[model samples]
Target: MDSLYLLLPVSVLLVLALIGVFAWAVNAGQFDDLDREGWRVLEGGEEAPTATKAQQAGVPLDPGQL
Candidate 1:
């Protein structure tokens, strides 16, 4: 059918566009820092749980206090 001719070219163009975008991203170092990005999702070792100012000063929690 005539619609097949139009759809074929459109699909090919879309695939080409996606490939071009992927190539551009690769050339721009968008995928270079894989390890750094991966580790960011894990718990960071540097940050430790600490008490707030009120807790540090031995303040009692009121029922309304956040």
Candidate 2:
């Protein structure tokens, strides 16, 4: 019973803190354009990774290249 007094307040405070953080994130544009980054990776741009470049160039790739 005594533990409930401490735990309940702590849990409530923790939930409130989490809600505050989420609200702040929404106001700060953190959630904006969430899909743009996902699309960017799928849509492969001009800049390629080293492994991809070596494959394109037909050069053997070392472990570092990967």
Candidate 3:
């Protein structure tokens, strides 16, 4: 059928476009840190290294209070 001639080329073009996008993603480092994120979740995630008592109290730390 004549429709097949149109549909076939359109389908091929779509497949090629998808492949191009996937290749671009690979070259752009989209998949580079795949495992690090998974491992990070298992590591209990990051937390600030320290917080002062005044910070927790929502008050500016006054040296006199210490």
Count the clashes in each prediction: 0, 0, 0
Q: What TM-score against the true fold does each predicted structure earn?
A: 0.61, 0.68, 0.61
lDDT for each residue of candidate 1 in 18-52, tens digit (9 for 90 to 100): 99999999999999887996687785678788999
lDDT of 2 by residue, 1-66 (tens): 999999999999999999999999999999988999999889997866565665888988788855
Tens digit of per-residue lDDT, candidate 3, span 1-66: 999999999999999999999999999999988899888779884776777776988988778877
Ranking 2 against 3 by TM-score, winner: 2
Best model number under lDDT? 1
Which candidate order results from sorting by lDDT in descending order? Answer: 1, 3, 2
Candidate RMSDs in order: 4.3, 4.4, 8.2
TM-score of 2: 0.68
Worst 10 contiguous positions by lDDT, candidate 2: 47-56
Flag regions of model 2 displaced more than 4 Å. 48-66
Alpha carbon deviation, residue 51, candidate 3 (Å): 14
Highest TM-score: which candidate?
2
